[model samples]
Target: MFIEERKFEYWMNRLVSHFETVNRKIDKLSNTENKINDEVLLDNQDLCLLLKVSKRTLQRFRSSGKLPYKRIGKKTYYLESDVHEFIQNGFSKK
Candidate 1:
């Protein structure tokens, strides 16, 4: 009877350890997904800061189609790469 109880306790400990490992994996995956989403939603504010431009100028660029953007419902998002390309194009002599 004592041996059986010991075996049950060992299995319970193994199960608890497995649960903790799975929980950690889930937490890591969630954090990675959040980071990816944050990257995609990096906004005009970040672009303005990077380009040293005003909000009004940024809006003008958006209206003129000089800067491509993503419109998610009413929110506007700009990719960092697009902002860099815009700056590069501004410096181009064509």
Candidate 2:
């Protein structure tokens, strides 16, 4: 069975578009060998490890609004952008 030219082109175009989107996402995830950027989602433990602090310190940061995070169920997540902003703004003890 022969496919119509227009139908073949449409399917090919859609496949190409889907591949392009997936390729873009892959590049975004693995763009750097060593550095993951602001698009990454980080949990509390990752934040504490990155900042070299205890889990309690992270809890205090969240409680005092020194950092911003999202809570889904019992787990929390912070965007790398927010953590970067918090660092750039200089978090200090009162």
Candidate 3:
């Protein structure tokens, strides 16, 4: 069936408007994700790699209370800020 020019233009405009709204929502969600990533938690391996240390050394820090960590079940996680502070305060094995 043949369609009128006006109706076709109207449909195209509506489709474009819908896509614009969807794009804006996607952009907003990405920005929120970036903000969350700023406070990202680091697991044992990530912390070790960042500090260039071994798992045994990390255990020593935790045991001596030199580094702060959160344990959930059998896994341990450290906050990025805490690691930065630990570095700033001069991490040394006693």
Q: Which candidate wins on TM-score?
A: 3
Candidate 2 stretches with Cα past 4 Å from truth are 1-38
TM-score of each: 0.51, 0.56, 0.57
The list of candidate 1 runs beyond 4 A from truth reads 1-41, 91-94
Q: What's the true lDDT of residue 26 in model 2?
A: 95
Best by lDDT: 3
List candidate 3 segments past 4 Å from native. Answer: 1-38
Q: Report lDDT (CA) for all predictions.
A: 0.74, 0.84, 0.85
Alpha-carbon shift of residue 25 in model 3 (angstroms):
19
Residues 1-94 of candidate 3 have per-residue lDDT tens digits of 9999999999999999999999999998876521124676778898889889999999999999999988867988887888899999999746
Model 3: worst 10 consecutive residues (lDDT sum): 31-40
Clashes by residue pair, model 1:
none
Error of 2 at 78 (Å): 0.5
Candidate 2 displacement at residue 61 in angstroms:
0.7
C-alpha-based local distance difference test score of model 2: 0.84
